[model samples]
Target: MSVPALNRAPDAVTTRVTAPGSRRRPDIEGLRAVAALLIAVYHIWFGTVSGGVDVFLLLTGFLITGSLVRAMERDGRVDLAAFWTKLVKRLFPAGAVVLGAVLLMAYAYFPRSQWTTVIDDVWAAALYYGNWHLALGSVDYMAENSAASPVQHFWSLAVQGQFYLLWPLLVCGAALLAVRLGRSARRGAAVAVGTVFAVSFGYSLWITATAPVWAYFDTGARLWELALGGLLALFVHRVDLPGWARTVAGWAGLAALVLCGLVIGDSLPYPGYASLWPTLAALLIILAGAGTAANGRLSANRLLGARPLTWLGGHAYTLFLWHWPVLVLHLELTGLERPTPGGGLLVLGVSFAAALATSWMVDGGVSRATRRLRTPAWSLAAGVLFVVPVLVAGSLWAQSIERDRQLRTELSSNPLAYPGAAVHLDQDLARNLPSLPVYPDTTTVARDTIDQTRACNALIDQTEVVTCEFGDPRSDYTIALVGSSHVRHWFQALETLADQHGWRLVTMTKNACQFSSGEQRYRGEVFTECAQWNDGVMAALDELEPDTVFTLASLTSVRSGPEEHVPEGFVERWRQLDARGIDVVAVRDTPRFSFRVPDCTDRNHRSECSEPASHSMAERAPYLELDDVPANTRFLDMTGYLCQDDVCHGVIGNQLVYYDTNHFSYSFSQSLAAVMEPYLLEAAGRAPEAELTLAEAALSPEEAAEAAREHDGSS
Candidate 1:
């Protein structure tokens, strides 16, 4: 399973070691160093989670809560403005530096298609809402093919920033309520914090069970981890363990802290019960050092306080900020998904250097320069200097991407200039691709790939069948295409044919769902939503009673391995259509690849990305092997046209075929319209019309423009 991209811990709100009344806890600071290192190591070597993020959350809760409680006792109220001033000044300078650097690196190293995501993430990270942004994207099926954002690791910082904003307010409320009830403010706050811990923890368990991907980045689901640390803070001063007991407990907790990531990796559900291993381990270490004076021989206090670890701890904020981006930059620069051990070391070394330099600029230069003018207002102003330039650059870069999309939109108008798949179909149109520019260039191919059925299709959650009609909608001759996204993406081809044949085109599709009732699973859970959608599609077909029902009779599974077969449910559906005297076009399912075609084509010549015919599908269509075929169901296999001579080219006739790993590009579908015309017409129980000349058969310039305009989304 692909783990969610939330694999790192974050910095605390501030790097101030000693609060007004509290002494520095170098051990906890060094734990921050441990957390930061665990994240980097686990990510680069294990390719999984390390629970380091939970440790960071626990540390933030303990330190920040302790600071706030002390202030409440001393000042007689929670100092909101003072806390905010210190946080914005101390935290954002280094954060802004990282975001700016990521933006520049993304522009240089990342693909243009990824620029939009980087632009959004840069602003979101700058404004402290990146966690929510990532939470939403985690469940977006369309974003499944995307590469990790350079600044994606900033989500943990965003979560901490949000907590810092709300923690003070919650404690203040608890303090006010305590005064009204004649109770100690500290005890009252502890009670409130415990309540938050319980509720958030319960919600975390439920969300992780049902939607683990979204749960991983959810601030609400993670709030309890921080609150647990808050509870530890309120009670730590009272833990009066014997010195020997403290030493033993401290070492045990340290061992457990390192073990949590390795033993309970991301293969298990996280920020839930599994997260307790790391959170409680961090709390135990902090508790062991509660009355810190001298370090024990093997205690966490001594181990974490090694001079180098302490230094990394002091600068953990910038180290956390720089490590993931540095690692991702290495991957983007080289086309490798994961680095070699030596490469990982290089990434870490670069991360350490960048972190130290960034820390010096933020801590030494900025703090020193502002020392004389070190008012709350001055800190806020200085932080803004780091943030505004990045936002401005993001806005300008976003505008440039839009212009690139607009220019590419014109490529569809001149067919001769970029004939796409037509070059493969017609002898006169055949041309070498090397000289002609690929329309919908690699820079914007992702945009060109549209949800062709969004106007008619159901979302993953939507059970009600939705339909959209196109191409001579009022015509008596009609065709209804029903199935999964494969059928949806084929709409351009069907639409082109319907326009020529003067037939109404109806599409019924749901993402990740085929017209089957065999009880499939989506994201490792029973796909009840898809099952319900199939039933609804059946009902809709009965009501419309179109001349023919078009669907994929065979299917391919990229996960199950490279082979094609007919699902029993597909045969049942075809038989039902046949029983109703509805003619059917059971188009053979297409091959799905393991890599995103656009990304591969961007870095390599398009032809170099081709897969072998054996990997594309089974030797022939599986439905043809059936003992008894449904009478009215005519199967259409275009594998011959798609793959020839034991090789499936990624680019054919100067046109890229698949948009993502599985789906066809809209232009490629249009190019296939004429090729599939005879079988589709036969499926609709209509005789073929006289063939037109290649020039006459092609979509007119006006029709091409119309097809482009009719495509979904702003692009």
Candidate 2:
């Protein structure tokens, strides 16, 4: 939500601010205050949206339309340059200030892994494309559980700024066509805005239902809220309500805003049709009191015009800007997920004070100085005062991170320094025992994922069992790696063995999806997408019929605790493989630490980062106890290589072991190749040489048809 000052350029264009008079409405001022404060309160304590952003969008559309339409009507040509320069003056100064503050906070507290992202967001916010940046990150499955960005709240401001850049051109273009056809310019602009509302609203609805997380920050999905506000501005004067009716509508609209936040904040998709609740509520408040007095009896409009609210509304822009970062920073400083009531009040008080001081220094002092000249050039130049410094600082910070990465990459080249799991697996390879520096650089550890090993797993929403082939694709011996991300991480070892032994390797993995015959759940919801993907995997496996099918037979419940078991899904998948006469090499599940291993290792000694290895596995393999298990199924245990003395350490053989909480580091996974080679060879050697073409022929006619259908539908 931008400050109203950004919309309040000189009256040369906005003289027709309302139908009744050029003076601003006190009730609208109060409404702006309510919107800004509601966002702050909801963010601090409720951890849910308050739809205050939707209200702000409506206000901007109404105000911007009034300014532009009036300018075009008076001059016959819209001054796009002047409008842009004025916007720069009113918005950039405050935006730069906030971005600068965020950078300082990030440097002080955020981990080194987060610097690249923070810098990227600062650049995006500075350029007013923050919304797209956020939308893309939201859709990327690897970005899950990321720390909250302080500048994430700038997304709405970016959407508003983008609208400012495009809306005037649209209005001017439509007005010209209208004049050629002898229609009124205002009527033409209204038609154009209405079309935008309808088209954008439809897209919003479709996108919201299909990809709600991405939709929340997508500019296209949010454009309708602003367009709806523009429509209100174009014809607001045509409405004339009785005083008592106006009062009733005004009160109802305000209550509706409060209720909208309470009812649908967490459950429903936003800025689509669901957002009409708050957008229309704002429209009601505007329409009810448009160009009217608030002096009637039993007046909701009069209540809105209370002195304190109107005064606070004057500072709404800066208040909104300051509150979010302040809340996020306070939470970081306190190590609290959310602030207590006293802490919330403390955060609010500090944000209010900062807003006041910033307003005085920039809005009052620098603004008064800029107003003396009042030229477009001066406004732009003055607004750029803080922007240049932010860009320079961000550039320096990014370069420093890259420099540190280069240094680490060069130092990690020595095999003796980072032998990974080799020191334990191979006793002959001698080096300084436990005194070596950790490798893969824990500062940049999150990137040390299976993607670095294979770059081939599907995202969570993906249902296609896409295959990534490595090593000798023409080799007669084929090994199929299938399962969730846990198994995907083992590709570092599999790919190494494939290269050395001249065997073909194919990986079919989904991020959190296990190749299961039974029902699978992700985040406690029925994983229908994974179920669909599993069917595709079965079809593909039928066509490939590899000598040995390699997958996980055990599961580690990462969220609950460090505990391992052979799931029914694992047994079910192996059972189908058994029916096909394919050999199985099921590896025991890896230990998944409940805490961030890299984070712990970064700040503590190796001893402090160790977890009891007993927590990961039972005294005996759980799969061995199951009745009616596949006779051809074989088990592989590398627990001795990963754990020693009943302990699993964060850093193994001088290499960081895990990137996130559960997944293995690419380097550590590669280190297990030598130890795992013998077990894989034994399973593949005993398997019968069954041609895949014959396996396909063995499928029933109905099964073949279904497999063909699945292949056609896969991505």
**Runs in model 1 with CA error above 4 Å?**
1-23, 292-295, 432-434, 451-456, 461-478, 496-502, 523-526, 558-562, 691-715
185 Cα displacement, candidate 2 (Å): 1.6
* lDDT for each residue of candidate 1 in 1-715, tens digit (9 for 90 to 100): 1111111124454444432236566677788889889988888777778878888888778767777677666666755765676677777788889999988888787765566778888999999999899887776565577788788888888889899789989987897788679988888889999999999999999988877888889999999999988888888877757788888878888889898778998668877788889888887788777764566776777788788888778767777788899999998887788999899999989998999898888778987788676556876787787788988998988888778767766865677656665654444444222334455666556555653444577767678988888989689987998988888778889899989889999989878898886887787778998999999888888999899888898887664563688888888888888888788888888877777777777667665667765665777678879987888888887665566565665665557787778788877888788677766655565653554243345444344333333331222
- Top-scoring candidate (TM-score): 1
TM-score of each: 0.90, 0.88
Global local distance difference test of model 1 = 0.76
Error of 1 at 310 (Å): 1.7
What is the C-alpha local distance difference test score of each model? 0.76, 0.76
Report how far residue 264 has shifted in candidate 1, in Å.
1.6
Alpha carbon deviation, residue 614, candidate 1 (Å): 1.9
Write model 2 residue lDDT over 157-200, tens digit each, in one string.
Answer: 88998998889899888988898899978889999999999999
Q: Which stretches of candidate 2 lie over 4 Å from their true place?
A: 1-5, 8-23, 295-298, 426-437, 448-455, 523-525, 559-564, 603-607, 610-621, 639-648, 686-715
- How does candidate 2 score on lDDT? 0.76
Residue 495 C-alpha lDDT in model 1: 90
